[model samples]
Target: MSVVTEPKLISGNANKPLAQSIARRMSMHRGMSVGLVDARVERFNDQEIFVEVYENVRGEDMFIIQPTSNPANDNLMELLIITDALKRSSADRITAVIPYFGYARQDRRTKARTPISAKLVANLLTEAGVDRILTLDLHAAQIQGFFDIPVDNLYASPVFALDILHHFRGQLDDVMVVSPDVGGVARARELAKRIGAPLSIVDKRREKAGEVAGMTVIGDVSGKKCIIVDDICDTAGTLCKAAEVLMEAGATEVHAYISHGVLSGPAVERITNSVMKSLVITDSIEPTEAVKTARNIRIVPTAPMFAQAILNTWSGTSVSSLFETDTLVPIYEGMYSRD
Candidate 1:
């Protein structure tokens, strides 16, 4: 018989609340005390990051929860330095749990001289000594190929689907899931199937970054309540434009379910003025005050999903089963009910 070792959970400066929530869930599931690693992640006067693991992690399985969110460079560096610290401390394994992967939208080169920043970020994590990666809803699926180590890309579709059910309360026949652009049709289709709704796509032309020149509805959304779905909503330009086109095409109501809410610059303002009734985003990235103050935006916590994923990873079990949308409602309701 082999031995079973307890895993150690650590958190970087990014998204501390989410890390804490996951730690609690893990502890609850174990029915024993599971604690987070006590560590200090700070910066120097010259802005160099420093990380210290206060406890001995020698031979222990280590998982660091750090979303490469805003202040992307700093959070990214923190993740790297924390991984290096755990590696130097002789941890048996290191898995970086990135709830929101930054620079993911730059996965491909639209122009000849453009750099593929997503691959560069992946290379940095591997070189920083990460044995595996756990992330949610990568902007591009092909980004998994950039990593040499095992990468588990979790989906937020189940979470969104559950919320949709609760929001609409079994009135899904008139609802339709829409892809904001051609690239996101697959994700939208999966979500539509999960929610038992129709599927539609918006054909769009991007004149430049953070700008959508035009959008055309590809399917019949007439008299249907459209739910635009996508992975990220950075500047909210495309989302707003899509909503307009969908409404023009006679959608009864327009809402959106996007995974990451980067909400940079005029995003909140744009969303506030858009035709969308509500913009539901996951709490993968820590929300800013502007997000909290946005009237039309609502946040769904992803902590339970991520917590279960961490537990499964530590036990060497497949987490893909948890990805099924049908399993989400009960899991989410149970977890939140206890709170």
Candidate 2:
């Protein structure tokens, strides 16, 4: 329970479960109350978004919980409308609590003359009168620099580490941590140090989106159980391809721990046919029907991490430690840097 000084909670149509959990954690003290306004959000004739808040919000600190995950445009519009409604009603401050920020991968222009949509999204949020931003495990860490407001980026590795320790119990040496691509080396190395396991990397020559060439393994993965970790899993192509590479490198078993599972466009079918024994993803964003019913996909509830983060944020505490890496095994010096 956090000692909340003063604040009120308001939620949108997106991600109600996470909102409720945050509300419960932040409201653990006295002299503070929070409630969500019944929002009537609808699309008009030309698919334009319309919204109305059905309650009073005068002088209240408002937090709108929405994950711009699936149907990215609609969810982003919903968040904008929610902020505008609260602002017009004389709310003291408005905070956009997005667990999964979509359009994060477009942080830069890789192709010639392409747009940086992440910066555009940041501009829209600022124009919508959002005073602060709270999100988790962005695909690109640099996305935080795009926001003009105070941005708190939380991490879920601590939550995942505890679950992994529970899964492996006393035997930690048989495990090996792997990053799906070279870009995710930091995340993979951190997890490897946590479990006292060795690290491996995937060398993927990506020809195009949803297409990667399985070249070779970069570390010692032979005869070890492989655990691939990543920040986002969009089409599942990178994940499945990396899994197959680990198998070819003599990994006895393969599993994955991904944060936001944006399983889009035939991802489930491909993951079902992949060699990985299981793929575990967090519920930062709501799971679609395909992901919820997938045979190989398993969801690890992030309720506790969300709860703790909400508590810390409301109480004006440091959340930077939560952003650090995690492990159950003692950290070996050269294996990974503890700094």
Candidate 3:
């Protein structure tokens, strides 16, 4: 496939603000009026999604910015319909920019009759004519293999690390990064390495989904400022419980940095009432009213990183460099620099 100079951005109803932010970042980088494509994504009386592209996109590089977050099925269907519309409109290349990919937790079958929904979602997107996939912090890294097309899984660790550094202001003493579970040790370790902090793990057993049976701290956290790092925080039972456990273990204070804040059910309440000082989440998934109003919850923007990623993908440049600790500072500074 040949490269297209002008890229067209299209947004679904999933997260319009984030899409707009990405477009603004792109425009700032390119020094041109790079805005979203003129398209109408709406629903009928019976809630059937309908998409119509008003502007001509023939032979144009197209990017659809839509995260399949809450109301997962509706948003997922909207993405498919949008992709189909773009394909039929003769767009040269179609890339789906999904910040938060739904059905990711169901990457594998846990029971006899269960299905691998993550793979199924990938197949659906492929069948819908998505040429490339760009997502952030997938629950499982192996989910990339589910797609036959090119998959670019971006890490939020660099962004998280910058925020953590800014929050702590170079204070590395008595700080600890804790993984909520054994599966998340890698993610936590990456953040710890970036911030030059010690790493710990919370060994937890799950009786079922969203319920923690028991937990054990794998490292010393006594009298230290504990920071829990994880990919997703749904229901937040494990997260809140882990924070309580850390306090009981004599930690001075606790905080959390999660990539995707699913925050379903009693998650917000749990975080609000828990011993954690603050819960910082990325804006991959749009924050709901509860999340926005939560006292101790904070959000870090991902638009700059994603905007840089999209530009890299469009220009055939290296996307991995954005996550490198040394390179990330200059790149991030450049994003906000007026020069």
Task: Give the top-scoring candidate (TM-score).
Answer: 3
Could you tell me the TM-score of candidate 2? 0.88
User: Which sequence of candidate numbers ranks them by lDDT, best first?
Assistant: 3, 1, 2
lDDT of 3 at 325: 58
RMSD of each predicted structure: 2.3, 5.4, 2.2
| Model 1 alpha-carbon drift over 4 Å, by segment | 1-4, 335-339
TM-score order, best first, reads 3, 1, 2
How high a TM-score does candidate 1 get?
Answer: 0.95
| Candidate 3 regions with alpha-carbon error over 4 angstroms | 1-3, 334-339
- Model 1 root mean square deviation, Cα atoms: 2.3
Tens digits of lDDT, candidate 3, 1-339? 655778789999999999999999899999998899989999999999999999988888999999999899999999999999999989999999999999999999888999999999999999999999999999999999999999999998887877777777645687899998888999999999988899998899988876688999998899899999999999998889999999998899999999999999989999999999999998999999999999999998888888988999998899888877566666576432222
Better of 1 and 3 by TM-score: 3
On the 0 to 100 scale, the lDDT of residue 84 in model 2 is 90
Q: Return the number of clashes found in candidate 1.
A: 0
Task: Please write out the lDDT profile of model 1 over residues 1-339, one tens digit for every residue.
Answer: 323488789999889988988888778888888878999999899999999889988888899999999899999999999999999988889999999999998999889999999999999999989999999999889999999999999999988877887788656888999998888889999898887888999998977876677788888999999999998888887788889889999999999999999899899999999999999998888889989988999999988888889888999898897888666556576532311
